[model samples]
Target: MEIMLTPAAKAGLDEWESNGNKKVIQRIHDLVESVQRTPFKGIGKPEPLK
Candidate 1:
């Protein structure tokens, strides 16, 4: 499965990294990887957009 971020999300991530939130950025990447590995059973509960 592929994960694509919206433009706003990309900008927010960039801003977070630029503001020295490397750890948070890494955690986001980790979560993405986890979701990729197990879409319905990863770190956080998976929910539908509704």
Candidate 2:
């Protein structure tokens, strides 16, 4: 699944983090990192030349 935040979600995340919600910030950061590790769309080893 593609993990992402919409503009509104991003705005809310920033606002909440600035409001001393470290736990929420940490969770979101963790989620972002996890998603980053996923392979990009169609990423794979090259096919053999027949």
Candidate 3:
């Protein structure tokens, strides 16, 4: 599956690889973790009829 990411976000990921920026990696990982931990209860898209 292909995914699209913001330019800044992509750069953070790349920096983690090339420069091994541990802080940046940790910050990004924390952000993703918080998102996953939070419950998304707002309006969501329903499966389209096929």
Candidate 4:
């Protein structure tokens, strides 16, 4: 599965990085990788929308 960030999310990430939240940014990247590896299992609970 591919991960696509919304414009708002991209902007928020940019803002965070500019504010020196590298550790948080790294964690987010790690979470995204985890989700990509296992969409329905890992880190956080995966819930179906409908």
Q: Which residue window of length 10 is worst by lDDT in model 4?
A: 40-49
Candidate 4 accuracy as lDDT:
0.87
TM-score, cand. 4: 0.77
Instruction: lDDT winner between 1 and 4, please give it.
Output: 1
The better-scoring model by TM-score among 1 and 3 is: 1
Q: Which pairs of residues have clashing backbones in candidate 3?
A: none
| Clashing residue pairs in candidate 4 (N, C-alpha, C atoms within 3 angstroms) | none
lDDT of 3 by residue, 1-50 (tens): 23458999788688786887778777767656554555342123324458
- Stretches > 4 Å off in candidate 4: none
* Residue range with the least summed lDDT across 10 consecutive positions in model 2: 39-48
Q: What is the lDDT of residue 13 in candidate 3?
A: 85
TM-score of every candidate = 0.76, 0.54, 0.45, 0.77
Cα lDDT of all candidates, in order?
Answer: 0.88, 0.69, 0.62, 0.87
- Sorted on lDDT, best first, the list reads 1, 4, 2, 3
The TM-score ranking, best first, is: 4, 1, 2, 3
Error of 1 at 25 (Å): 1.3
**Cα miss at 49, model 2 (Å)?**
32
User: Where does model 2 exceed 4 Å of error?
Assistant: 1-5, 39-50
Pick by TM-score: which candidate is best? 4
Model 3, C-alpha of 23: deviation from truth (Å): 0.7
